[model samples]
Target: MAADDLPDEVPADPALSASADPAPSIELLAGPLEIVDRITIASNATFVGRIGETEVVYKPIMGEQPLWDFPDGDLGHREAAAYLVSEAFGWDIVPRTWLRDGPLGVGMVQLWQDVDPAQDAVDIKPVAAVPGEGWRLVFEGYDDRDRPVALVHEDSAELRRMAVFDVVVNNADRKGGHILEMPGGHRHGIDHGLTFHEDHKLRTVLWGWAGEPLLPDELARIEAVRQDLDAALGETLTAYITVTELVALADRCEHLLQSAAFPHPRGRTPATPYPLF
Candidate 1:
C-alpha cells in the first residue's frame, strides 16, 4: 500500500507487541517482516515495522539510491557499521542497528527510537542575535529576500558526545533532524549511511564544540575504540566497508587523540550540510 493509505502510526502486531524485550533477536528480524508504515520523506524507501516484539526502521538495499561518493548497494551495511563503532565506544548514541534480509531484500534494520517532541535542543532556529547560554551558534546567514538570520543549536553534553561520534565515523550527512531527543534528555544519532567514507567528510550541525579540548572521559572512550579496532571493531566493520575505509577510521581516531581537540573543518566542500535542519 502507498504511504498515504497507511495510518500515521500502526499498532504493533499482537504477538510482537506482547513481549517487552528491549532489543529484538537477530533471528526474528531476519525472519518474517511486516511493514506498519512508510517514511516517505526519506531518500530511500524506508519503513517502520515489527520484527517480533521490536519496532524497527528498515531500509532495504533495493531501495537505496545510487550516490556519486558512496558505492552502490552498501548503505545498509554502512549503517550497521556506524552502530558497531558507536557500540565500541559504549557511547550509546547510535541506536541498535543491524543488517538483515527483509521483504525487499537485504537492508539495515534499526530499533525505532521514540523521541520526545517537547525537547528542542537539536532543533535549528533562525534568530536575529546569538542565543544565550544554553544555545550554541552553528552558522549565520541571510534568509531568502536578504534578511539576516543566524542558525544556532543547543549546547548540551549529549550533543557533544554525538559530535564526537560523528567525527570518529566520518559522517558525511549529520543533518540536524537526525538527532533524536529521547525521554530523560538522552540523545540518539541516526541515518549513518553516509559514514566511513575513507576521506574526511564530517559534515554536521554539532560544531558548537569545535576547537574545544577533549575531556579526559571523552578521550578514554576514543582510546577504548582504538584498542578494540584490531579485534572486535575491525572484524565487524570489514563486513560493511572496504579495508581502506577501516584504515581511515583508525587514522581518524589517532588524529583526534593526538589533537585532543574538536576539529575545524578543512578542505573545499562546505563543512555543514545544506538545509541545516
Candidate 2:
C-alpha cells in the first residue's frame, strides 16, 4: 500500500467521539509519549507509558509476531480498527485506542484501565467447587495437577455484550488474560490484534450462550451496525481493513441479524485457542 493510502494517523477528534464526552488522553497519545516500563506479560513487545498525566499501553508494529494465518498487515492497525468497531457499538467494550508515532516508531496507544485486584471475571475452579449461580460454565476439563476443573466466566450483561462484539469482529483470540475487570463492575476487552478475519475465526471462552437467541436490545445494536456498514462506519474501517474484510464485517452483522442468535463454532467444532490462559 502506498503512504497516501494509509489511514489518518490519529483518531477522530474528541468532539466527535461516540461517548459525547471530551477526553484529553487522545490528544496526549498523538503528542509526547514517555515510556516508563516494559510489560512482560504479553506475547508481543508491550510497554506502559505516560502521556502527560495519563497512563497508556503501547504496542509497536515492529514488535508484532507474524503469523501464517494473519499476513495482511501488522497488529497495530488491527488494534486501532478494533477500537473503531467497539466505538461503533457504543458499548464501551474497548478502551480509547489510537495509532500514533512513539519513541520506537508508529504503534497503537490505548488508555489504561485500572483493574480491581480482588476481581476475577474469568476463572477456573475445581469442578465440584464451581458456583451454582452468577457464572456460566464454558467447559469442564483437567488441570495441570490432573484434577477436574471447570472454565467459567461471570454471567453478566457486560460479558454477554463482549461475546457479541467478538462475533462481529471475527476475533481469533479472546483469552482469559485479555478480559480486564475494572473497578465499577465494567469489563473491557483488550488485546484485539487477532481480530477481523474474513473467515469464521471466533475463538473465545464466552461461548456459554451458544446458539441462544439475541435479546431485543442486542439485536437493535447489531442492526445499527448493519445499517451503517455502508456509511460512515464502512468508510472509517476502510482506512485499516481491506475491502474484503469490510464486506465480511457487513456479512457478519447481517448473519447475526438473520440468525438472531449466538453462532456455534463451525469447522473446528468449538475452536478454542491454545495455552488457554
Candidate 3:
C-alpha cells in the first residue's frame, strides 16, 4: 500500500470504545502506508495502524512527566512479557504482541481478529452485570452468502479463562472493546498495558472463576514459567523490566503456588482509574 493511499486521519468509528475523553485523532507514524491513524481505545492506551494487515497498538511512553501515570513505560513492557509467557504456557488467547515505534513514539503492536457476533452467541447479561461502564461495539459479520451476524459473546468458558489470565497478570484495564470475538470460534485478548504491579490489581470481567482451582494443565504451565525464569527468557524480561518489577513478577508466581489459588489483591483499587469501554 502506498503512503498516499492512506488517510491523513483515521475515520472515527462509534463502534469502538476508548478511555481518552477527547478521543485522540489517528496520525501517520514514520513507516510505509503500514500504519494509518492513531486510535484511543482505552483510558490509557491507543491502537494505531497495521503492520502488514496486523493491528499495531501504540501505547505512549507515559511516566510521572506525562499525563498518564504508567511508570517507566513498564506497562507495555509487562504486556510483552505476559504475551511471551502466555505463548509459552500454550494459551491461545493473547494476540501476538511486539515492541515497535508508534505514533506516540515507541509502543506495542498486536494482531487483530475478525469478530462476527451472530455466528458466536454469548450470554450478555453476565457481562452486563460486570459492574462498570464499557462500550460494546456492534459490528456486522457476513457469511459468503451475505448473511448478517453480530459476533459479541460475553459468556464463554475460554473467554472467561483469558480474563483470568489478565487478572493474574494484574491487568487494571479490561473492557468489552478489549475482548475481540473473532470469526471461526476465536476470542482474542488485547490492551494489556496495565498489569504486573507489586500489588494485586486483578480488575476484569472474568471474575467468574475467582477462587477456583487452576486446572492441572494450567498449574503445570505456571510451573513451567517458574522454571523458565532463569533462562534466556529471564534475560529478555530483565531487558525491559526494572529490578523491582521483576521481583513483583516472581512474587505473583509464589502467591499462585502458596494459595494453590488465583488470589485477587486485597484492597487494590480498580485496575483502571475510571470506567472505560
Candidate 4:
C-alpha cells in the first residue's frame, strides 16, 4: 500500500498516520485486500491487511462458526452495524469498520487500533492489592492457582462511555481484551459479531457503573442515537441486522434515555465473556 495514494485526514484509529487517510472513505473500505497473516486469536477467519498504506483487520463471513442464535455468514453485517451505532453516538468507540468483499469473501474490515502497551482499561489484580483508588470492581474470584484475584476496570469517563455503548448495542461480549486502550485514553471496543440481538444480552467486565445516573453528555448521546434510528441510521442498518433487531436497538436507546442511568446486569446469560483477557 502506497502512502501517497490517499488524502490527508483519516477516520477512527488510522493504522498509521495522516498519510493513510487524507480522504479516508472509499479506498479503505472498497479495497483490493492483501492478506499479511491471520489474527490467530480471533475465532473466525481474521486477517491483517491493507488497501493501500492503511492497516486493517478482516473477518471473512465464510470463516464464521455456526452460532446457535445468530444466522450464519452474517457476522460481518452485525459488526458493521455496531460501527454505525458507535458513529451515531458521535464517539468513535468502535473504530472505523465497514463491510467489503475480501481475499476470502465478504467480510468486515476495520482499522487496526494501535493500543498503548502501557495502558490497560480493564485489569485483574491480586485481591489483596490496595491501590484501587480510581478503579471499579466487577467481581472477585480465584485464578487458576487457587489464588484470590479481582476483576477490575479503571473508573473514568472514557470507559464509562464504552460501557454505555455496550449497553445500547446489547454487546454480548465485552471481554477485557476487546477494550483496546488507545494512546490518548480513548477506549475502543471491537469484535461485535455478538451484538444487536433482539434480546437483551449485555455482558461485560464494566458493571462498575450499574444503576448510576447517566451524565448529561451520556444522555445526549443516547437521545441523539434514538432520534436517528428511524431515519438514516435505521435505513443503513437494514442491510445488516434484522428489522426486529434494529427496532430493538432503538428500544434500548429509548430505555436508556428514559431511565437516565446505567443498567444493572440482569440476564440468564453469563454477565461476562469467558477467557476475560
Model 4 spans with C-alpha error above 4 angstroms: 1-22
Per-residue lDDT for 1-277 in model 1, tens only? 3212223322112112234233464346546668899999998899998877778899988899978888566888788888878877887888887766567766777889988999876554566566789988877777886777777778888888889999999998888889888999889999999999987788998888889999998999999999888886687677678899999999999999999999998888679886677
Off-target runs (Cα >4 Å) in candidate 2 are 1-20
Expressed as tens digits, the lDDT of each residue in 51-127 for candidate 3 is 54445556654421222445454566666767776665567767665454444555555555567866433323332
Please tell me which predicted candidate would have the highest lDDT against the true structure: 2
Superposition error at 268 for model 3 (Å): 4.4
Can you give the lDDT of residue 127 in candidate 3? 28
Give the runs in model 3 whose Cα sits over 4 Å from its true position.
1-33, 44-47, 53-55, 60-69, 102-104, 119-155, 271-273
| Candidate 3 accuracy as lDDT | 0.55
List clash counts for every candidate, in order.
Answer: 0, 0, 12, 4
Per-residue lDDT value at 166 in model 2: 95
User: Which of the two candidates, 2 or 4, achieves a greater lDDT against the reference?
Assistant: 2
How much lDDT does each candidate structure score?
0.80, 0.83, 0.55, 0.82
Number of the top TM-score candidate = 2
For candidate 2, the TM-score is: 0.92
Pairs of residues at least 3 apart in sequence or in different chains that clash in candidate 1? none
Question: For residues 63-179, what per-residue lDDT tens digits would candidate 4 score against the true structure?
Answer: 998688776568877888888898888888888886666677667788887899999888888989924679998899998999999998999888899999999999988999998
Tell me the tens digit of each residue's lDDT in model 2 across 1-277: 2222224664443323445445763344456789999999788889998888989999988788888888754688788888888888889999988776677777788888899989998889999999878899999999889999999999999999999999999999998888999998999999999988888888998888889999999999999988778888788877777789889999999999999999988896346766677
